[model samples]
Target: MQNKYVNKVLKFLKWGAFILIILIAYTIISARITGADPSFMGYQFKNVLSGSMEPTFRTGSVIQIKLTEKEGTEYEPGDIITFQRDGILITHRIIEKIIHGDAVTYRTKGDNNDGPDIDAIPAGAVLGQYTGITIPWIGYPLGFASSKLGALILFLIPGVIFLVFGVHYLRGWRLSRG
Candidate 1:
């Protein structure tokens, strides 16, 4: 009787883990061939949380970013780009780029923003351009989970439930053998 549920759950876990592993491997291989590595540190997500780039990108968009800047190519004005600012990820358009010998300065602004950004963004601040975004509402959960409360709910609750389920599953296996 209990063996049936145990078998079902174990089988499900096996297949689920197998599929997840295969998908992850495939993603890694695809990234390598495409000249990118698509994983984040500590399983992070760099998402576009605001409507700063409208008519093209909306709020609740997941933008996969690549670290490590490419050199020798000067990004020009009107090129969309993403960059790290104070450790946070930001994506905006380059409205101006001034090349002074070895130094490069940039001015960036959001498309939907009223005016250009108040500050002049140096070339060092730019990361990369807007590559892609997931579906609108579908990415909301992801963006939300990156937040404080949502992180707790998304990670802690599921972790606790999985632990409880694992214990119950092992207990059932032991009881069945007795």
Candidate 2:
């Protein structure tokens, strides 16, 4: 009975470790292939930092955005978009659209804010439109994956775990041979 229980636990641990390694590999490969460019593949992921869009998407939410091209794309009222302002990315709803000759501008406001934004955003500065996919509270861990500590957590910890397991298995093999 004791040996049977030990075998089951070992099998479970082996499968769990295998899944963890695959997950880590996939994450790193996808991020590298995407090159951290928001415009790449017309899709990007961002972490919600504020309660500006509260009730719609709370803070610490992860949102996937699809980039909108300047041509053949019409800005509509009530559309959520991510744009760059003073080197920061802001996500808000478009309340109005203003056209000047060949150029277009957008009036945006946070869903939780009382008034529209002070300045209109030009079409050139727009990043992407929200695809309405929000995963709650995942942004915190994803945020960590972009930092030095994140690298340690994602790579080092797993590597260490695998190494310890390998050493233990080798020791068992040697004991069985002797």
Candidate 3:
């Protein structure tokens, strides 16, 4: 009975791990394919690559940006927003908002930056506002997973372990049958 209970627990844990791994794999792959930030349920996952937002968010921190309000009402001065500039995503705080005729523009600056950005950021360039959620040091692994070699290692480690265990189990079963 004790052995049976142990087996049941072990089986439960194995399945749990498998499900979790699959979920993580799906998220990573989806993020890579989508080209947008990895997001679920209105929350975006972003990795801070620079210290520009330091004192607020440090480098190598993983931040969760939650969508607040509807599209038109969400942006305001003092809000930290992520935007695309030259094909790269940059996160900064909005220092000013300029309205010219029908267009809305933002002046942004990093907390640690010496001055505000030279160019005005158009409203269309904004991705989403930060929700103040941060998980420190998680960006390092996330950043690593972005690379081809890192992804291979992340995927293969679990696969090789499972393969080895499966082979061992099959061997044992065969010997028992013989």
- The models' CA-based lDDT, in order, is 0.69, 0.86, 0.86
TM-score of each: 0.63, 0.72, 0.82
Steric collisions counted per model: 2, 0, 0
TM-score of 1: 0.63
lDDT of 3 by residue, 39-58 (tens): 67888888999999998999
What lDDT score is found at residue 61 in candidate 2? 97
What CA RMSD would candidate 2 show? Answer: 4.3
Q: Model 2: runs farther than 4 Å from truth?
A: 1-41, 70-73, 162-178
In terms of TM-score, which candidate is strongest?
3
List of clashing residue pairs for candidate 2: none
Q: Which residue window of length 10 is worst by lDDT in model 2?
A: 35-44
Model 3: CA > 4 A from native: 1-7, 67-73, 168-178
Rank list by TM-score: 3, 2, 1
lDDT tens readout by residue for model 1, 1-178: 9999999999999779757756755665676689753565412235667888885677766665444355413688887777767766677888888788888877888999999877776777766555454456656787575467975675567567667978998999999999
Sort by lDDT, best first: what order? 3, 2, 1
